[model samples]
Target chain A: MSRPIYDRVALIGLGLIASSMAHAMKKWGLAGSVAGHARTAETRAAALEIGFCDEVFETAAEAVKGADLVVLAVPVGAMRAVAEEIGPHLKPGATVTDVGSVKQAVVAAVAPHVPEGVHFVPGHPLAGTEHSGPHSGFATLFQNRWCLLVPANADPEAVARLRALWEGMGSYVDEMDAAHHDLVLAVTSHTPHLIAYTMVGVADHLSRVTESEVIKYSAAGFRDFTRIAASDPTMWRDVFLTNKEATLDILGRFTEELFVLQRAIRMGDGQHLHDYFTRTRAIRRGIIEAGQDTAAPDFGRTKSAGD
Target chain B: MSRPIYDRVALIGLGLIASSMAHAMKKWGLAGSVAGHARTAETRAAALEIGFCDEVFETAAEAVKGADLVVLAVPVGAMRAVAEEIGPHLKPGATVTDVGSVKQAVVAAVAPHVPEGVHFVPGHPLAGTEHSGPHSGFATLFQNRWCLLVPANADPEAVARLRALWEGMGSYVDEMDAAHHDLVLAVTSHTPHLIAYTMVGVADHLSRVTESEVIKYSAAGFRDFTRIAASDPTMWRDVFLTNKEATLDILGRFTEELFVLQRAIRMGDGQHLHDYFTRTRAIRRGIIEAGQDTAAPDFGRTKSAGD
Candidate 1:
């Protein structure tokens, strides 16, 4: 096995991402000892019971003590508080990073708390399932996925070391500016999630369409939207709140495009609708070719009991 | 072995649905012989080469001759023409059914041409992958899936026989009015597909975010939309055109709900966004409980080559 990248790694939140990191670090020997902390006692207890972490601390500050790397894996809204609590406890030369969905706001909220000698890098891993919580994580969660780092004037060596840690956990790492990360994520993740939530909500609110009807007939396509809509409420809420500008901008574009398609449908312009659909099909092909998604039918989803 | 449901069955479009039906029928011995027809010679050749059909005919009219069951599996826009051509050739005491996404338009287009003593049942099978064509089918595609029959004044015996055939093919069958089926499907299928296409188009058209970036980071929720958006453009275009009112109605409600959530995000109303997201989560659980979809994360999608 390869030598551990960090002597001691502290995970400041024992949620899906952090727990997955713990498992991957253990699997690959990426870190010598993994310590964890969560705001809720239930989560801390659960993380300890899961046995992914070597030690579980009650406070963020206690978790970061003497650690070479500290990961703030809380909701983006909670990052500032966790960063402040752990700021004084972090080792002088340690690097502090986060696994938040939005980079710009996370940087704004947590960067100010880092001490002069400590390196602060904000990262957003472009991987997750709709399921959340510590138990929902697995060692292979980051395998073949991208983990983006926003160096933001941090020391190059610190950034390189952090990239190595993620790469050791089976991720391909890339570096980009914080603002660009936010805008790209808004287009790729945030806006899509919000649109899915809205569509599901519309189905819920329709009087003519019973909830049972929606559930029974969901195999027709709506079930895909529901999968993303089933994501953690608090985490997604913070994502939208913190990444407000870019998400709103994307949403604006989405609504504009939707209206044009709507008009084509209303006007009986099959050619226009067909042309638009054909163009979008090429993008799906691009994603499949780029190895971001499987090309299998229905994502090669296993049959449920109903099937 | 039990007797076959129909002595001769003709499938009038060798796409995913019809090809799957051919395989399922052959697997279960549900039909004595299956005759197939496609608009394109390439599809007809492929269907014959795949060996799912016992015989391939050049015209829908020729395929329906002497057959007790004739299935119109063409795109909704092509249904009327196929029905006109096959009407005179359909055998007496035969059943003519269609496997179209929209019911009301299909009923209007095909019902007028039904000959005396022939039964016309319109069905919408709530099962498919993002794939199409003759070879993109499997014997178990309909297993545990719903096949809704819009039996509009059809003979009771014909409806019962069709129901038995679907059940033999491993589908759970239900009966409903054409209008109700259209509205239900608009909520569950058509509107969701249009929304997915629109969102993907927005991403494709955005000048600032490169296509490569979107494809690389797609695992963060955007990939789900791409799967549905990648469905057959001609079929989807026909669906939107034929089921315009209900789809537009659902889309309108979608935009309205989206605006409310957008306002909540803009106003920093975390409570509203959180509550909305929480409510939508229940719908996903309901879908899982109903056996409409698998509960596994990311639809239990297999890792692509990148993984």
Candidate 2:
């Protein structure tokens, strides 16, 4: 679809993000050749089966050799080990990047392992689905989605080259500091995910003993939370563990807010609850106005899907 | 779609549920004629503007004058007043129903006002969007959604007639006792909504003074919570206040579960979080398989509208 930005792009982890990037790059012809590797042979086989990559390797070191770009798409907790395994094999002057959710930790885990000539640019694509694994990747996952690039002290040419590649793949690129990105994501993604996991976990525990028929007759609202809770647990567990400070800070604020609302519910303070709900509605409107969210009714329904 | 089930149907309080019922009734020709009433003249005019009813009345008393079926669709808090205002004017042997979320409270509030001959069958249709007011209703709002009927010793024929009307409108009708309905809704809808509202409120607070840009970078997960949080504040406030006992019970469980998760995150217990999240995924899978949710990668996207 366009000129190739990198001669050979290698993905060191062939999971959802890696597979998606491979698909999008191949779809747009942004890379001369895309190669993939996974810790498991089954995933490598799956990647080859999906035909998103030109070749699939069994080892991370094998995958990164001679590639102009190497994507560390593994879990955040696995970043250090994966970087150590693939660092020496990276192509000279290669621009190394990652698609991990947490940035500051990823940078700390990865930067020291990179060779001096190679570039290390960390990014967090603010996009995903409830589904995961190699088969779950889709080419349009990054379209219109925000991809925050945290290129800490990297060569400007290398950062721009990475930005251009992301832009070519249909992502809206933004640059932000790692700490600020972590804090923003704590409020926007991490804390909310923890809360959703908590609620769904509560419902699931109730389903085991209680007679609310929580799953059998869950309404649209609870069902939405279930979808979020159903996301990959390993990734989320790693996320919470790695992004500890920011998530804990947001969670503390959330607990304080929850206690206040809980007291209001207990005291029958309708006005307080009404005021809070009304205030939150404006942020939802802001998200829609900013085109960050779809204005469609979007609760697994037909009429509101296209609106 | 079927023979007219009611000679005349009157909808009280022209909000989302009432306007939607009017549209659905008109869509299926389930009623010979439809009339609507709202305390606000603007709502009455808006109901008339929607062209779903044959007439729009200014008073609840005048609206149910000769109707064979009268739907009390006001907020749960106002059910008693509306019931009392219209009780004396209802046609003898008419079916009086409500689309309130809380069942026991509604029955306690409205049953005493119903005339001896009139059937008081309280109900809750588990179908709605974050939008509200007259303009937010749609003909397919109830399509394939569950409408729980809490007839509670109401005449069998009256309940059957109401079920038939809902069926004609494309909803799956189910019957449950009032207490059970409240408990089920507390677990499935009420607590989920309250948690979403709290999370969004937390996000809003952070966005004001914190340099996080929380709203601007809300990922797919948090955006879903914003939609739920953006629901009509008045309706939700009433839902919590009216369904106090059950909602409180669920909230207690949610807080307990949240504390455990917070502790786990603090202690870096990835296994605990993983097991909890993995267990919750089964409930989501069950919801999807039971046709209550969609498996179509619903991240505010274009797929899964009809699945």
Candidate 3:
């Protein structure tokens, strides 16, 4: 194995992303020691039981003490509180980064609490499964995934160091502005999740009052939405609450476009549907070519909990 | 190898589904002779070049002559025409079936044209890739998938023989009524495809207006929609047209439910979102328990064409 990238690494949240990072660190031997803390005692216990961290602490301050690198992996809405809690305990010359999906709010919330001489770099790894919690993590979760590093300033050395850490975990890191990151993720991640949740929620209600036939034949397309809808409830609630403006803006645009399709369907306009299907097919092909995600079925090699 | 299930098998409207069946038949030695016919002569030549069938015929009637089993694998909308074309040529005791998504319509369309002694068994195998055409087929495609049979009458011998045929191709067969089959598929398959098409269409238009940024940062969630959206355009168009009433009914319900979620998002209702997310999660668990699908990522085992 290569030399440790960091002397000590502290993770502030123990959900899917943070837990997966711990798995990656262990798999790659990237950190000297990995310590973690969660907001609740139960979660801290779960993290300990799952062996996600070398040391599990009850408080964020306890987790950050003497650490050379600190990662904030909580929901975007909780970044400010986590920053304030750990700020005093952070070692001087330590690097601070986050795995929040929305970057701008996270930076705005957590930046003020960074102590002098401690480098604060916000990062978002575009990798996760719909399943959450410490138990839902795997070592290969970040393999070939994209990690966007939104550093507060254009500091070449600090950025390179953070990039090295992620690269060790099998991620390709690219620098981007926090505002643009939020806007881009709003369209890519936020709006998509909202749409998925909305569609599944709608189908559920319809299934309840009607023939329940909606889900019986769910293999059509509603099955996909269910996977998205099944994502961590609290985390998604926080995502929408934090990424409000960008999400709402994109949602408005999506609504206008959906209305056009709905009208076409109502009018039996096959050309419109055909054109839309063809265009969408091209986008999927682009994604497959980009290597951002796999074109294979998500659960093909999945082993169950018992397995 | 096992003995051929039929001495001769005829495939009408040779496309993705029919071509795949031909491949499966050849690999499994399930048919001594396989003949294919499409509406277009070019398709017949292409089928011949790819060797998807042992023989390619110019007319459906000619293709079915002397065949003990005939499969109508055309677009659901074209079933009636194909049924009429091949009905007179069907062998005296031949078993006839279809691979249409909508069963009730196929029953109504084909039942009228079938000869007195021919067994008209409407079937839909829940197996496919997004790829289409004679060239886009593999013998192993139907391994461990479902094939639903909606026989017009409770003829146990005919059903048993058809079940054995699907089993030979590695499918688990379930028998049900034609109308119920259509309704179940509407919820599982049809509604989902419509929404995916609509969402992709929405994203495509959004990308055009936003100048391509929407696609540049497509996250995991939107990426899923793109895959579903990318499904064959003409095949989907035919599906919607043939199953208009069932699709329209489900679409109407889906819209109403979507409105509820939209209202919740606009009002910033976290509780509403949370509860909906929880409910949808249970449905996914149910689907897994029923073995309708795996919890793993879509087709995670098979490498993509690019790979």
Top-lDDT candidate index: 1
Compose the digit string of candidate 1's lDDT tens values, residues A1-307: 8899999999998888999999999989999999999888999989889899889988999999999999999999999998888888889999999999998888888988999999998888888998999898888888889999999789999999999999988889999999999999999999999999999999999998799889988999999999999999999999999999999999999999999999999999999999999999999999889888877788877654343
DockQ of each: 0.80, 0.60, 0.42
Per-candidate TM equals 0.99, 0.96, 0.90
Instruction: Please give the lDDT score at residue B197 for candidate 2.
Output: 92
Looking at chain B only, the TM-scores across the models are 0.98, 0.95, 0.92
Query: What docking grade does candidate 1 earn?
Result: medium
Segments of candidate 2 deviating more than 4 angstroms: A207-212, A304-307, B207-212, B303-307
- lDDT tens digits, residues A149-171, model 2? 99879999999999999998788
Q: Regarding lDDT, does 1 or 2 come out ahead? A: 1
Highest-DockQ candidate: 1
Candidate 3's error at A163, in angstroms? 1.9
Candidate 3 chain B lowest-lDDT run of ten: B298-307
Q: Best candidate, TM-score-wise? A: 1
**Which pairs of residues have clashing backbones in candidate 1?**
A307-B144
When only chain A is evaluated, what TM-score does every model earn? 0.98, 0.95, 0.93
Instruction: Name model 1 segments beyond 4 Å from true.
Output: A303-307, B303-307
- Provide the lowest-lDDT 10-residue window in model 1 chain B: B298-307
**Candidate 3 residue-wise lDDT at B91:** 91
